[model samples]
Every structure is written in structure tokens, then in C-alpha cells.
Target: MLALSHYNSSASPLFPHFSNDSAGKLEARVTVEGVTDQPNFSPGQPTTGGVIVVILSMTLGIISNIVALIILANAYSLQRRRTKATFLLFASSLVVTDFIGHVIPGALVLRLYLSGGVHHEDSNSSDRMCQFLGGSMVFFGLCPLFMGCAMAAERCLGVTKPLLHSSLVTKTRTKICLCVIWLAALCVAMLPCFQLGSYTYQDPGTWCFIKVLSDTEEVDVAFVVLFSGLGLTSLAVALVCNTISGLTLVLARLRRKPGSHHSAKSHDIEMVVQLVGIMVTSCICWSPLLIFGLMTVIHSYTRSIGDDLLQYQTLMVMGVRLATWNQILDPWVYILLRRTVLRKIYLITKCQAGLRGNMLGRWEPTSFPSSEKNEVNQV
Candidate 1:
């Protein structure tokens, strides 16, 4: 009776045979087993607003990431002079995760829009496609989430142990941490496919995920619960890490004995301010999806007695879209907060002296002591 969350899909990728029974086999039967109301999962295809949102998300996300990757890679290539290899590596991991995160899921959403929507019951091929997309969404989406936590932890270390952080968190160490995050996300994504739960259709017709609410055992509630649980836990860790890091910076500044270089002090305070903004924005964008997941399990948020499914479905769209909005905003947030982006632009425009002064003033240096690298400029 519960509609679960947006992660629901029509077939289990790990156990394809369970949903392998042909449509012909069920033709003589009035109803198919294990299949709930497919129609209820998504009331309709994406409306104009939904279509516009996804389109804009995919378009700009691609452009900004491509630019980010280029500038960052170039900066890192000159790493021996600019900063430690550790910062460069972590920055690269984040850009890669974010780019893939946006493109992979964005493509699936596009396919659903193009096909007028689909389900595993539509065909065996379609079944596999949905399973693949559903599994990928979980994997790719969580990669960025975990990476955010890792970064916050790094910042915390920098504030608490600046000297040790520089020596201890090396390139090899950072790579190991990145690997662990990816592997954990992969393992969690595989859970639903392996029969811990199953993916099924969700609203707006284009999306599929592990069902949050269901009347059948084959696609149980445990998987949906697991998905929600992991998501919230990661977010909580990120918040704690960022909060501690921000507070530490604040306290350090307040305790300063004065006579410190005003330029450097002001810059350090700005870096902390920008870092906190990123952490807060990330939470704002992602929290909606997790909240809906929690609300669905507690009780169908707006689907109780005398309530309309349309409104509940509307709420569902808002939550999923809110998560999608994060993918679009991330690169831009990086651009805005990035300390080196303006510097790079300024260097290229020096020949235009009339504009150089304005650009230089606007893009003033706010270097972090942990890594002089501009790409490490933003968390």
C-alpha cells in the first residue's frame, strides 16, 4: 500500500530470472504475481516543468564539469610547484565523481523521457536496461556523497592538525580512501539487485528504484530502508565534519594575538566562509530525497485516508528533483567558491590591461595554507 521512494524499479538486476516469466505465460491469468499497481508508481510522464528541469541539469552540468576538469587537470599537471599531490588527487576524484554522477543518471532520465516511459514488463531488454540504470543511480549518486564526507574530514584534519595533515594525507593515502568509498557505494548498490530488495517504477514515469512501500515479498521493504539509511548516515557524517572544521577555524581566528598579516587573516576567514557555504548547500539540495524516503516509511506522507495520490506524487517529484538540482548546482558552487578560477581567467586576460585590474580585484587570492593549489581552493 505504500509507494516507497523514487528508487523503485520493475525488475531485480541481480535476479533477472525471477521476473523472467514471459508476458505470454501470464496471458491466461487475470493478474500477474508479485507485481503491484504499476500505474500507481508513476501517475504520468514528466510534465513540461520536469522535462525542462532535467534538460537544463544535463546541459549545464556537462559544460561546467568539462571546463572544471580541464582547468583542474592543467593546474595539477604543474603540481610540483603549486601544491602537494594529495590535494590534486582528491580534487580530481571529486570532479570525476560529480561529472559521472550527473551524466549517468541524467542519461537514464532522458531515455525515459524519450521512450514515453517504460517497465521491465514492456520487454526483457527494457527490463535489463531499467535494472542497470537503477543500480547505477545508487552507485554513482553515493560516490559523490561519500567523497563530500572525505573532503570534510580532510578539512577537519587540516584545522586540528595542520602540520601532521600535510605529512600524513599523501597522494597514495588519498587514492586508497577514494577506492574504499567507491567500493562501499558499489556494494550498497548491489544489495537491491541481489534480492535484499528490487527496483521498480516511480512517479513521473521516467525513474525506477527500490520500492519503499509494497504488498509483495519478492521486492521487500528492507532494501528501501537500507537505501534511505545509508543516505542519511552519510549526510550526517558530512554535517558533523564540516561543523567541527568551521568551528575550529572560527576559534583559531578569535584567539589570534593580533599583528598577524591582515591580508592573510582576511583570506583565511573567507576560505572558511566559502567552505561552510558549500557544506550547507550540499545538505539543502540532498535532504529532500532522504526526507521523502523517511516519510514514506513512517506513513505515506500525503497518501493517508481521505488524501489525494496526486498531491503525494507531486511531493515525490519535488524531492527527487531537489536531488537532481544538486547535480546541476555542484559545479557552479565549485566555480563560485574556487579561489583559482578567477586567477586563471585573469592571467589569460592580462593583455587586455583595461579589464585586468577589474578582474584582478574581483578574483583576489584567498589561499589555504594546507594546499596552495587553487583547485583545492574549494571543498
Candidate 2:
């Protein structure tokens, strides 16, 4: 949800000076005699219930991400037997970014709750913390989305130009691509501070993001062109690439007319599922916030302070929660939808249960999913 930010020294008294921006940062004013201070949309410690909920989310998200990482590591080790797919490095990088997106903000948001608005307790320190956390959240949150775009693009290259892809999409190149993803995310997140766009804390005070609304025509144009433009571009590219890749697998399977084996068809289905899961989950979780931001900017909605806006703020908080849930789900997407991670998880379970009899060798896989690389992407 698009939101605003501000800090009120005390709880909003009738008409509290706390106003929010499109980025969800609260804007506050300090009156020195007759002159009013600039707005500071710092976070406020709202209900502990919110903190408790996010803490649990953070816990689950962290655990799932760790499990995914372990599965990837095991799968990567096994991959030494064959030509390791460079695709896995992208997958691992995405998971890492998703983990950061969850943990870092989750902790900072928890502090905002536990400390009861410590950011407001001292403006100087809080300002510094806000700047850091605001940028950190934006960078981490957007990084994973773009990384998905990178994955989609890579898959497209692999399908359309296999020989070239095999030659060009090397381990070193994949690493470089990942670095570029992070660097790009960092640059976009910092643009708001330069007055090109806006970033701020929103209602409930746990999250900060790009401003969705513009106070003037000039800023409104900038917000639309940069903030919404970048988000939509990345999401559109990801969706298109994933859709094309999924269709290619399905068509390839369909084309295997006479000698089409059951396993081959199943592999096509699995690929479709994985790609669809990623695309759908991402859209469901993130599209609302971005779309709403665009609409608000176009309409030129004004950011207002006081208790009257609390209901609107409360409703909008749902968007933020959904986006956070995406972080928890990304790792699950890998484990549940991808063949390699799924097989690893299955083996790990058997191992922990002392079912060595089920094991073929020290680390050899006994599952059908892992028996053939032609069926699924490695890791």
C-alpha cells in the first residue's frame, strides 16, 4: 500500500502532527515559537500485536530461507558430478536477498515496537537509523524481484539460444549478473534521498518504501516516471519471461509425439508449476502496492496528518503484510516446486529418520526427480 511517514513526540493528541507520505514514512513538524519545523515521517511504535505478528513472520521466513539454503548447498555439492547449472547461482542469490529483505526490516520493525518508538526518543539518532533502515528495506525488497527478472531472462536465453547460452552464461558471468542486480537495487533505493522521488515510513511504522503520492505536479511526474516505472518494468519483464519459458516447456513436451515418456510429460508439468508459482506469488504479493502507488500519484492525493487517516492507514497496511509474506513464501517455492530442492528435502527427511536403508550410497539420490537432469533444472 502507498503511505506516508512522520513522528509525533507524543501520541496523536486530537490532531497530532503525524502525517504520512506515499512511501509510508510519517512526516512530523516541530514548532519553534511561531515557526514550524520540517516534516519528519519517522516510525511510531503502534500495537504490540503488529510486532508479535511480524516477529512470527520473520521467524518463519528466516527458518524457511535457511532450509532452502541448506537444500541448495546439498544439491550444489551433488552437482559436482555433472555440468553445474549456472541457473542455481541465480536461485541462491534470490533466496539470500529474500532472507535479507525479511530479517533486516523485521528486526528493525521489532525494535520500533519493543523500544516503543525509540526512533522518536531522539531525533538525531533516529534520523540516522531511519535513513539506514529505509534504504536497506527498499534495496533488499526490490533486489529479489529484479533477481527473478534476471532468472527469467537467463531462462529465455537458454531456450532461444542454447549454444550461445551454454557458452556465455558461465559461473563468472552469473556472479557478475547477481552483483549488477544488487547494485541496481541500491541505486534505485537511494534515488529518493536525492529528491528524484520519495521514501518514508508509513502507518504502524514497521516498514518504509517509495512514496506513492506526489504533493506537486513536478514530484508527481518524477514519482510516476521513476518509482512506478521501474517497478512495473521489472515485474512486466519477469512475468513475460516466465510465461514464455513455461510455454516452451509445455510445447516441447507436446511435440514429443510418438516416444513421449510419462516422465518427460511430468517434467514439463513440473517446470510449468515452478515458473507459474513464482510469477503468481510475486504478482499477488507486490502488484497491489505498486498499482496503488501509481493511481495515487496520478490522482494527486494529499498526505494529511491526524487520527482521521488512521482507518485508511490500517487498511493499507494489509498490502505491506502481503509483500512481507512473499519473503516467507519464496524459499517454500524453491523447496516445494523445484525438483532438486524437493528431492533434497525428501532425502534429508529420510536421513534424519535413520532410514539409511533408503539411501543408495553416501549421497546418491534415490528419488525419481533427481535421477535425470534432462527432466529438471539443477538446483
Candidate 3:
């Protein structure tokens, strides 16, 4: 998501210009240019299909995130150990962020659709709303990525270096880390308000976000590049941490003696699995938006005015749509992919297989696999 700001009459052709009185009161007078000033470059209205899809998906996302939060709360209350509690803290924060990600910006989008979309000229109140939405797009967009990386790092330390993790990771430190992550994202989002870059209405006029223009000042281009770089770097850190944690868990399980037991091993595996889901989801959903923004910056010097501009706008719209899926799909990772739920799914599949074999008169009841037996004992 991007942001919008009040600009002068010399604003870019793609954005509106604002004026104010001597007393700093926003005047009623505002001007905006025609899209591209060419029939061939005019963008279409937000389609009914698109509006319906946003409404339904946003609704579902909000509900799912709420459900995930509830589950996390319940799980947190049942946990007596410090490490698990810390993880639940991080998970709860991520779910809350995802919920707000869908609610605040999603509500703004629905308002635009219901009101028949933004016009050539917007009122001061509307401009402020766009600014809020743009900042939200940046803040919420980065929070999940940052949180995923944090979670993965936490788990990697726990799985690969238990003694060190126990000594270093505490509830107080975890809470502070969450606050720092949010503050970092909020600071980046607010940088535009300090004139590093400006937000403007995106293609089709349904949303506003960080300006991704080729003709903008060098600072603005660098701002977009900075955002893209942060997102990609977060994803990279998460991928590396998740890989190390998973491999470490596998090797540990293989090395465990038949009668030996580490009660926390199962919990660590569960947390690692959840982190992998988050890493994969973030990578799949956000990579396009981040990569597209970077590509636009790299090619800004060679960008054309007519068809190329249209292509950029269209692709960005699609990229944002993909990015929104991250929030929607994130909660389900915790909801459906739990160790208990997965164990149930495995049992169901095994039962079905046994039934099929019995009907074919080749049934032979067998003992549970050693791994399955171990999981059952742990539970």
C-alpha cells in the first residue's frame, strides 16, 4: 500500500495538487489532471468483480486472523514454560498485526469502492485518509515480514543452541523486541511524511501507496528502494533461519537414543514447522511487490511515457493483490497446520488405507511407526 500527500499545482501529472489559505486551513480549491492526458492511457474504473473479491477476501481474512488470535491466547494460557510462552507472544503479535492489516486498510478500500472510487479532485479529509492508508500499507506490509524473521531467529537459537537460547531469551526481552520491530516499521512508514517520498493514489484509484514513479526526485526513488530492500532482506533472514532450525531438528531426532526423551523437542518441532509455513507464505506473497518496486527503480531511467507506464501501473496493481494474500493465508498456518491437527490428519489417512486393504482381503493390522509412536507418547 502507498500514501498520499498535499502537493502544489506543479505536482506530477498522475497526482492531484492542493492549495491552502494563509492560516494553514485547507482551501476548498484542489486540482487534478486527467490520467495520462491521452485516451489510450486512461485507466479503467475499479471493477465490480474486483470490489466483490476484495470485500469477501478481506472479510474472510479478518475473521481468520481473529480466530488465530483466540487460539494463540488459549495456547498461551495453557503454557507454563518460558520458551513456549515467548513464542506464543510473538505469534499473538503477528496475528494481531495481520488482523489490523486487513481491517484498517481493508475498510478504507471498501469505502472507496462504496463511494464509487476516488475522484479527480479529493477533499482535505480524503487526502488525509489516503495518507493514513498509505502509511498503513507500509507499516502493516513490513510488520509480518519482520515478525517472521524474528520468530525464525528465535526458534533457530532454541533448536540449535538450547543452553544459549535459555540464557539469552526472556519474556521481557521478547516483548522489547516486538516493540522495536513495530517501531522500526512505523519509522520507515513515517519517513514519507518527512519528505523522503510521497504517497499517491495507485492505479484504478482504489488505493494509495508509496509513490513508484520514474520521474520523482532521487530521494523518492531511494525511498522505494529502501522499502523493497528491507522486505527482501527480512525474507532472506527468515529463509536461512528456518532452514537451519529444521535441519538441526531433523539431525537431533535422528541422533536421539530409543529410550531417551526430550519433552521440549516436540514443541520445538511444532514451532519450527509454523515458522517454515510463515517463511514460505511471506516469500510467495510479498516477493512480487518488493521485486517489482526494485525493478521499476532500476529501469526508471529507461521508462517510457505511454504503454510502459500503463504496464507498470497494471503490474503494480496485480503485485499488491498478491501481497494482500499474505495476511489472509498467514493465520491458517497456525490454525490448521498444528501438530495435533496434523497428527489427526495422519491417523485419518492411515485408517482409510487400512479400510481399503481390508475390503481387498489383504488387511494385516500393524503397529504404529516408531516416529508415530514417539509423537503419541510425547502428546
Candidate 4:
């Protein structure tokens, strides 16, 4: 139990303070400042429940991400097609991002727990760690959503217009696009440093994030809205692109025009299925947190002071837990849902159908045409 009651009046190292603390232009303060008055300030005691959950989530996420990366690397090496290689490269990058997301933030949380929660002293060193942790959360959290959207768009183009895709999209261009996605996420994460919004330690002192309901309600609302809006938009784009790709593939399969390459069609189907799985996983796992963020900000906008503090805290914690699951479940989408797996399933189903037909033939009399009867007798 660290206990010290001291206040400081210096500019936040992580972000700048507003020159004028007007109603609209409020200061963007980082949560690590030990400001007891702030809504997001840590209570200085680490909850056993929060610690246990973080440990379990971190452990599973790290192991899963590592295995997914290994699987992706093997696939990438085996791929003969440049298009496939590019997709694999994007997949490998997403896994690496998730892996780091778990390792870096998890390590920080563990360190905070071991140190007995937030320090009493308001020092530069303490602020730096919190800033790093918050920034890591933002960067890693957004990368998967953005990456999924990009993958969906790429596959949609490839399936809908192969000639255009081949002519315009290349390995170099894909790599550059990936870098741009990463850069965009990094920029959003660093926005707090520019005083657009602020990062603060959340309840139980286990994690840090954008301040949801702060004194500077306008800035807080804007930042939260920005983060959540980006996530929702990415998910929406992924949804549309995947739907178009899936429909295109289904239509192509239905038509089955002469001279169409079965192998290529199968490849497109597999890719689209995998992309859909990713899109669904992202929506299920991340929507809660993103939506919760939007709601929280909206609620803050409507109400200056919160009436149900406990409820808000509980919801935030639950939202964070759900969002963390995205990384853990993402890799398995590719591992389990693949062309080889689907082929095996199809074979089993076909065998079962054949066996049932044979059993029925032995139990019930069946009539055949004279030509079929003659053919059977000849055989």
C-alpha cells in the first residue's frame, strides 16, 4: 500500500496541457500523473480479479500468436504464387502485431502488479511507462482491424476483377500498403502526445487508455469517438468487401463456365472463406469494446457527471476483456478453416452418403432402365 498525498503543477511529459483551460479547450492530461481528482485515476490498489484475468489472457494470447506466426511462416515459404505470398506476408505481420500487443502490455501490467500498483510519486519515469503502455494498447488494438479491412479489399479486387488486380497490385505495392496501414495506426496512437486527447490509467490500475469521461469533456469525447469510429469503419469496410467477394465467388461457381480453371476457382473460394472468417472474428470480438467506447463518450457528452460509476467501470473492464480475445482467436480462423480441411470434410460427407445409398439399395427393391440393367449384368 503506497500512500503519499502530493500534487504537482508541471506540463505532462506524455502530452501537453492547454494554455487556457476554457470550457471547450480543455487540457489533455495523461492518467499517470497521480491526479486523484481525475475520473480515471487509479485507486492505488490492484484488484486480485483484474490481475488474474490479465495474466490468463496474456498467457493464452502470447502462446496462440506464436503458434499462428509459425504456421503462417511455413505457409508463406511453401506458397508458389506471388499473390498468395503477399497475403501470407500480411497475415504474418498481423500475428507479429498481436504477439507484441500481448507481450509488451502484459509485461507492463505484470510489472505494475509486482510493484504494488501505481507509484505515489508523480515523476517523469512513471509517466513514461504508462504512456508507453497506453500507446501500445492503441497501436496493437487498431492494427488487426485495419489489416483485416485491407485483406478483404485486396481479395475482393482479386476475385471480382482478376485482370485489373494483376495489373495494378503487386508484391511491392502490397508491402507498401501494409506499411501505410501500420503508419496510420501509429499516428492515431500518438495523437495523445499531440494533445488531441489524453491517456489515463483505468480502474484497478491494470491498464491505461484514452480518458473517457474527464473534466475536458469535449477533448475526451472527440478522442474516444475518433478511436472507436476508426475501428467501426474498418469493420464495416471489411464486411462489405468480404460480402462482395463471397458473392462473386458463389456466382462464378454457379455459372461454372466452360474453360474455367477449377483450381483457380477453388483457390478463390478458400481465400474468401478465410477472409470472411477473419471479418466475423473481428466483429464478434472487437465490436463490444469499440461500441462501448462510443457509448461511453456519448454518455459523457450528455451527462457532465456520471451517476452510475460502478456500472461504467464494470462495463469498461468487460469490454477490454472481450477485445483482447480478438488476437487469441484470429490465428485459429486460418488454421482450422482451410482448403485441405474443407476437402477432407467433403470426402467424409460423400462417403457417408454413398454408404447410406448402398444400405437402402439392399433393403428396398429398385427398378432400372433396360439399358442400365444390361450394363450392370455385363459388369
Candidate 5:
């Protein structure tokens, strides 16, 4: 098992962002046999193959997220649609979170590796940086989780209580809700910044993460249970809520009258389905990682499990990295489901091509009658 005390020592710079304890000193030592001494196996120690994967994932994620952002920003017609605007806004926020949570962090890890695996030292600046990065990661990570819940709820309202949805789900109201979601996530992420035991660098020269439990067996077990339990519980709630909402929308659509209005309703159903698909995909990708993360915390706390080192490391690595694919996948979701965005992109491309072609062509202006000539002819 990993020893909490071993990680807390001064020599390792895994978490250079937190301050040393009141002793104003750190003991630096390297242990070779135990979990504490084991390679962290996070982005810090990413193999050459892993680095290539990270680069590809981050590049794709950033580009896709940027496209999603542009779709939300420029497609005014899409914004005017009722539930679409709300969904688009949430989607945009999710993209932002994904960029921060995955791409930026991945880049930092790459930079660290390039610098000879030197860890950040615990200093005032490092502590602040840790607080910022950790806080942002938590905030963005949770945003999509909750926003999925919100999107689900909105679909439920639109289906089960169309009148109410029509009255309540306005652009301004959605903006307010989005703001609230962000604020709540920020609050959750920031809780550790103010407390000492709440945040720590994982090691002197490795990844920084939340300190779930100490090296003590009892504490480690409890810590694992806490984080795992919370993550599972949240996953359950989100899944249930989204499922119910999706069903409600489907049922409502079945009862609608046939016409252009019905066709529009069908489109709405498809959009909801796509959104639900995104939500479900996200849940699947994240849930296992959360469970494993919690388990690691528990196992580390107990110090009883020794042979599970490789398994634990694999789980941790998978949990952190796999969640990133959601960002890369989001742009495809928008393109597949959003007609307005597609139309606008097509029009813009066509206009650009036309202009270029005209510029390349040897062209002459067509002669037309002048205003004076036209007036004399008429007289």
C-alpha cells in the first residue's frame, strides 16, 4: 500500500503546489518496495506511446471543442429555438470544462515530462497554482455531470408539462441556470483550497490530487469509501434523471398530431435522444474511473492489499484519461443533431468558394443603362 507519510516528505515534488506542515520542514526519502514508492503512472510518467496518445487526444479534443464553441456563438437561428438554446449553452459549457480538464492538464504533463520529470516544489506560487488547477479540474469535471442532469430535466419538463416549459424555459432563465451550475461546481472545487488537509500534492515529483486518506489502514479504507460512494451516488442520480426525461419526451412525441408541427416535434425528440446519448456515453466513461479512484483511496488507506498495485495503477490511469474522449466526441454530436449549425457552415463555405472563384476568373463588368439615359429614354 502507498504510505501517506512517504508522499508527504519534502524531497518529492509531485505536488509542489501545497505548503509544508507547521514544522516548516520536509523529510525527503525514497522507498522502493511499497505503493508509496511505486511509479505514480499518471500523466507524469506517460510512456512515449502514451505521450503520443495524449497529444492526439488533446489535439482532437481542443479542435472539436472549438468547433462546438463556434456553433453556439455564431448560429443565432439555433439559439432562437426553445430548448435548443439551453442545450447548446450547456453543451458549450461542457466543451469548456473538457478543454480545461483534459487538454490543458495534458499539455502541462507533457511539459513536465520534457523537463526531466522534475516535480513542482511546494512554495507559495506552487500552492496557488495547485489550488487553481485542482479547483478548475473539479469544477469543470462536475459541470458536465450536473449539466447532463439539467438537460435531462429540461427534456422532461418539455414533454410532461409542455405549457409550463413554454412559459419557463426561456433564454434568460437558462442563462441563469447555467450560471448557477457553474457557481455550484466552483464552490465544490474550491472547498479544499481553504483547508489544509483538503488539498495536497501527491508526491514531491508527481501528480497532485485530492488527499482522501492517510497511510493508516483504517483511514485509507474510509477515504476510499467516501470518494467512491459519492461518485457512484451522483452517477446513479444522473442516470435515473436522464432516463426518465428521455422516456417522457418519447412518449409525448408518440401522442402528437401529424403535420409540420409534428415533424418539428419529431426533430425535437431526435435532439433529446442525441443529448441523452451524450449523457449516457459520459456516464459510462466516467463511472468506472470514479469507482476505481474511490477504491484506490480505500485500499491505500487500509494498506492491506499489496499485489493489486498494477490493477490500481491501471484503473487510475484509465479513469483520468478516458474521460477526455467525451470532449472529442461532442462536436460530432452537434453536427449530427444541429441542422442550423450545418446550414450556416455550408453557406459560409459556399460563399467563400464563390468569392475565390470569381477572383481567379478573368471577368468583365456587364454594362447597364445609366439613370440619366433611362430617364431620357422614358421621356
Candidate 6:
């Protein structure tokens, strides 16, 4: 049976620290006894299994995000069209942020878990690392969220206000909007760092989570609530706007004539589809975590049924999983939006020597006139 003394000593400082050692020990003994008496009380550690899962998840996520970034960058470099370039630039920004969010922290978490110690040696270092990690999470995560919304808004304007859009949504305007998104995201993320000390690092035996709130009221709860709410609200608004615009475009296409310029219509449909996909994916990945986080904040203020701690932890873990999956799937959106990208891939494959012979292979032979063919043969 696990002793209460050990558990209490190791309890995260972010939570209410129990000072009565005797009482804690007594409670711990009772809890351990009760668990041992139960039929389903298997208390063995699952470190090996957890570590393996972390390693595989981190490795796969890294590889997938790298591939996504490469695909987007390559696509961006190949395109010359203004609209296509704008989409690629937006996609590239998203990919870069997603890469940092998935790869860096993931690797750090794995290392911390495997070593059974944090990378930060002292309290100050730990605090700094915590703030750094927390800030990075907020910055990178929010960038794509806002950029995506801007992309949607631009698309909507392009469709609904074609004449105005031609003048308003110029390359300069797009770049400015993107710049604003990054600045806004950074400002929102760093606000917490200034007021609250670094996020407390807690090892829950399975995964790492930031401890924004401390046991003492050292940080203003209001600031945390306000900033987090603002960030989430912005992301939610973007997602809704994007989804609406995408659906409108799709419906308009459906209502159009069958003989409409098929190529142009198809391209428009593809762009809308890609925007819708990105918006839906972002919402799916982020909403659960945001909702659960809000609930946690509310519960903290009320000091109510702390019994739901386990459930809250589970939800947070699920949220992390959703966020990480975003990195893996981002590449498909780039491919769907960019035509020059597809052409380049085809060209690259065509240049390969062995790939030339097959009829449906990468390369095709040029046809000559019969007269030319005969003259060449006669020579």
C-alpha cells in the first residue's frame, strides 16, 4: 500500500499543499488500504508502456510535421499567381508554428519522462523553462488559429465582394494581416508570462501539463481568465467565419450551371474545400481543450468538487492529442490548395530516367508529324 507521507511530499505545489503530515499519513493509509481491499486495485506502475507511447507519438508527429512543412515550402516557392502565393504564405506560416508546437515540446517531454528528471536543474531555471514552454505553446498554437481566420475572411471577401476584394485583398494587405496575426498571438501569450511566474512543471507519471495557477494567489486570476478567454474567443470567431464562408462558396457552386467554366469553378471549389477543412480541423483540435480549460478555471474559483480532477486531467490529455494531430494533417490542406505544387511533383518524377518508359509513367514522349517521322526514318 502507498503511504500518504510519500504522496503528500511529492504533491505539486500548484495545488493546496497539505501541512499536517500526521493527518496526511493517516488519510493515505486509509486510501491505500481501501484500494488494496478492492478487487480492481492493481497499483503497479506503467512507466514502460507510457514511455513507449510517448516515443512513438513524438517520432511520428515530428516526421509528419517536417513533411508537411517541406510540402508547403516547396509549393510556396514554385507559385507565381497572387492568390496562390497568398495561400502558400499563409500555409507556410501555419506549418512553421505547428512544427515548433509539435516537435520541440514533444521531444522535451519524452526526455524528461525517460530521465525521471526535468531538464531544468534549479528552481529559477525550472521557472524560466516553464514560462518558455508555456509561452511557446500559446504563441505557436494561436498563430495558426488567427492566420486561418484571416485566410477565411480574405476568401469570403474575394467571393462576396469581388470588385472590392480585388482592390482590398492585395498582396500587401495579406502580408500585413499575417503580420498582425503573429503580433496579436505573441502579445496574448506573453501577457500571462509577465503576471504569473513560470508554469509549474508537474509529472503526472504519464504526461506533462502546465500549472498556470499556484497554491497561493501570487498571480492575478483575473488576468489568466481574461487573456485565455480572449485568445479562445478570437480563435472561435475565426473558425466560425471561415466555416461560413467556405459553405457559402460551396453552395453557390452547387447552384451554378453545369456547363460553367469547369476548370475555374473546380479551382474555386478546391480552395473553399481546403479552407473548410482547415477550419473544421482547427475547431475539432482546439475546442475540447478550451472548453475543459474554462471549466477548470471555473472550478478553481468555486473550490468545488475537486473530485473531478481525474476527469479534468483526462480531458486535458485528449486536448493535447487533438492539437498534436493538427501538425500531422496540415500537409493535405497545402496540396489541395496549390496547383503549382502538383505540377512540380509531376515534373520531378518525369525527370527520373527509369520512369520514362511506362505509358502512364511520369514522362510522355512528344508526338511528331508523320511526314517528319518518315523523313527522319529515310535519313
Best TM-score among the predictions, by candidate number: 3
lDDT of 3 at 290: 92
Runs of candidate 6 exceeding 4 Å displacement: 1-46, 117-126, 196-198, 203-220, 335-379
Top lDDT prediction, candidate number: 3
Q: Write the per-residue lDDT of candidate 3 for residues 202-252, one digit (tens) a residue.
A: 656667777674445577688888899999999999999999999997787
Candidate 6 accuracy as TM-score: 0.70
> In model 4, where do residues sit more than 4 Å from their true spots?
1-38, 41-52, 119-126, 257-261, 350-379
lDDT of each: 0.60, 0.60, 0.75, 0.70, 0.55, 0.56
Score candidate 1 by TM-score against the native: 0.72
| lDDT of prediction 6 | 0.56
- Model 1 C-alpha lDDT per residue in residues 336-375, reported as the tens digit of each score: 6655544445445554665644423433333233344545
Q: At residue 92, give the lDDT of candidate 6.
A: 76
Residue 287 of model 3 has an lDDT of 96
Question: All candidates' TM-scores?
Answer: 0.72, 0.72, 0.80, 0.78, 0.68, 0.70
Collision count of model 3:
7
Clashes of 5: 17
> Which residue runs of candidate 2 sit more than 4 Å off their true CA positions?
1-45, 80-84, 118-126, 212-217, 260-272, 301-315, 340-379
Backbone clash total for model 6 is 0
> What's every prediction's RMSD, in angstroms?
10.0, 9.5, 9.3, 10.9, 13.4, 10.5
List where candidate 5 sits over 4 angstroms from the true fold. 1-48, 76-79, 118-131, 196-206, 212-234, 256-261, 339-379
What's the number of clashes in each of the models? Answer: 12, 25, 7, 1, 17, 0
Whichever of 2 and 5 has more lDDT, that candidate is 2
